[model samples]
Target: MVKGEVCSEGLGPCDDTCNSKCTSKYPNGKGSCDSISNSCKCFYQCLQPKPEICNVGIGTCSTACNDQCCNGNCAAKFPGAYEGHGVCYNVGPSIYNYCVCIFKC
Candidate 1:
């Protein structure tokens, strides 16, 4: 669990007004707080709707999708993930701030 930073390194604002939520970069996230802004970044990986964890060597990716979005088990299938079948597919660059997977089935 990440604890939001209360101190602002003397830049200013140390009161309740300065209270912010922790931010995370990865989905199925496995890291710590990313204090970039005020909104609490949803650590998708920690919750669900996990993002792509690519197996670069195999040119394939895998993850579990959000149950609310699809009726299926937490998937670990290949890319081209399909709903009701448990799979997720991704495309584009490797340095995405967020992954927008397309599911079919």
Candidate 2:
């Protein structure tokens, strides 16, 4: 997975107001919305015990939700992803940096 990067690159449903766009320009997310700058900034972080391979950051766009957020098996759905996810845990200037497949939890 990629290190020192944010993965909320997808632009999801504007009405949903939960998962918005991640930071990467070429890569992607299944995500979480945090209160940043008084905005419900929705984005994705990588998940782990690091995968056997790496990442494919799916649903990192505005398409995941039409009415609401998309929920289910991410690995089973989006594959062949060329990009990588983020780090799981960090000690310097990074928190749980891994982007997980977002589902109703």
What is the TM-score of each predicted model, taking all chains together? 0.17, 0.20
Off by over 4 Å in 2: 1-4, 9-11, 19-41, 50-105
Per-candidate local distance difference test: 0.27, 0.34
Q: Following a full C-alpha superposition, what root-mean-square deviation does model 1 have from the true structure?
A: 13.4
Question: Candidate 1's residue-wise lDDT over 7-79, tens digit each?
Answer: 1111232334222322223323322223433223233222224333321111233333333223233223322
Relative to the true structure, candidate 2 reaches a TM of 0.20
- Which regions of candidate 1 fall more than 4 Å away from where they truly are? 1-33, 44-78, 82-105
Can you write out model 2's per-residue Cα lDDT over 1-105, one digit (the tens) per residue? Answer: 333233343344333434334333223453444333233333444444443333333333233332123223343444335222222222134332323442211
Q: lDDT for model 1, please.
A: 0.27
